[model samples]
Target: MTLLSYAKAMNRALADALEADPAVCVFGEDVGAGLAGLTLGLQQRFGAGRVVDVPLSEQAFTSAGIGAALNGMRPVIELQIPSLLFLVFEQLANQAHKFSLMTGGQARVPLTVVVPGSGSRSGWAGQHSDHPYGLFAHVGIKTLAPATPTDAYGLLSSAIRDDDPVVLFAPAGALGVREDVTAPLVPVPIGAARVHRAGSDVTVVAVGHLVHQALAVAEELAGEVSVEVLDPRTLYPLDRAALVESLGRTGRLVVVDDSNRFAGFAAEVLAVAAEECRLLAPPRRVTRPDGAVLPFALALDRALQPAAEQLRDAIRAVLK
Candidate 1:
């Protein structure tokens, strides 16, 4: 048994993947230099031939990953910043994402895009701090936001193995997380929701770093309200069954997501529960204000993010 940090877990996964498959190659800005913490020392471990650093061209390099995948190579592309996803959206959504369907399963793009530090990084402002995971999920791209160090390793391993294009967002807030390893690291299924805490009252569905927040809130409200915390690791192929089962245990739902309220990931969970599950009360979502642009100030940035108190209040409201 060993202890591992989230960033180290990702690094280990990449190292294992590169070692397991000679066809696996990593290409992105500064990966060779290990500027992104997750790719630290990977270039040294694997030769420059496999960990080639590309020029600063998101669209071009993203398209290159698609091209590489179309061939026999498995390419892993790293975007240093989360918002850079927008720059490669056309390449991902139009080209790579469509190839499997457009080619009628004749071609597979086993491209994995890793966003090392996603979500409101303190004072990164509107452009860098944005977490646009919902956009990828909405467009049918396989999107995953891993909350724990173990899930970070497992999900990245799974994403690298999958034939379809996958986007992995490792939340900046959760990057510092460390986990105790009691069992061998293995691949976690893509579309699975993990129940962190079981409760009979309200179910709190959280994404990314918010899972930790929800669990903390659940513990705080242990005396009054029984809160069950659930983490939907994969956003696109949502585990509706697990969520429904959780709802069956607890008749109310509260979603606390780092994204915005309108058309956010939380909204989708609420919509799914409303359509499928029998809720005793209207589902509540604690998320950033509608179309929020996170300010550079610390207080302002923290205010825009969904807090545990907000989740607790939402849980209490739903319980009523």
Candidate 2:
């Protein structure tokens, strides 16, 4: 078995996409130098033309990528910082995402935007630490947050091949995750949820890096409570069927998301559950406080983000 790291898995996925399709091109700042680790060695392999590094303007380059998509090129834009997404909201949300529907399916924007090291990074402070996947989802953009190296590889590959504008957020907390690969990497379908562990007491829906925390809590609460860990890899076009099925079995839910609590991705999941599924007890959500801006201080940052203990408590609360 080969040990694959999450960052390496993403790099490999990008390399494979570059090799498989000439229409696939990468555009971003410092992509030639591979500062984000996901584009490492890709420029050398794919040549400077396919892996073009653009000017330091997020809006300009993002619009350029959208234009490239219109002209039959599948462009993958890598934003080194997640908050840069806020800078190009008009280009992404109003322009690229709406083009296909506006044209009545005449135009397709096969653009994949990758935000590596998304979410909180130690000492990166508030500006670089935002995990804004929810905003993209809210605007009807296809959003992905893969929790593991394997999921990272598969979901990224699928994102590159998608016909619509897609955003993939590689959470900083899961970047160091590693997994053993015994099979060849393949594309995982979008809007699918994976049940990491089976349980009958509570179904814990974890997003992005919180999937790891949910699994650990499940193992710890094995004797007293049966906790099922469900990873909703795709934030938008959520796997509502899988969610309903899991909640139907357990009759309890606890969503642990890295985003803020108000109108966040976790809130959407809870809304879906409340509307469609019958629960034995009230569902709980463990998420960051509303309007939380991560502090630069290490201790304060850790305190702001969701933790394993919080997830454990949420799970138990649902069970009770």
- Cα distance off (Å), candidate 2, residue 146: 0.2
Poorest lDDT segment (10 consecutive residues) of candidate 1: 32-41
**Candidate 2 structure quality by residue, lDDT tens digits, 52-162:** 999989999999999999999999999999999999999999999999999999999999999999999988989988999999999999999999999999999999999
TM of each candidate vs. truth: 0.99, 0.99
> Candidate 1: which pairs clash?
none
Q: Estimate, for each residue in 45-124, the C-alpha lDDT of model 1 and write its tens digit.
A: 88888898999888888888899999978999999999899999999999999999998999999999999999988799
- Quick one: best lDDT, which candidate? 2
| Candidate 1 Cα deviation (angstroms), residue 7 | 0.3
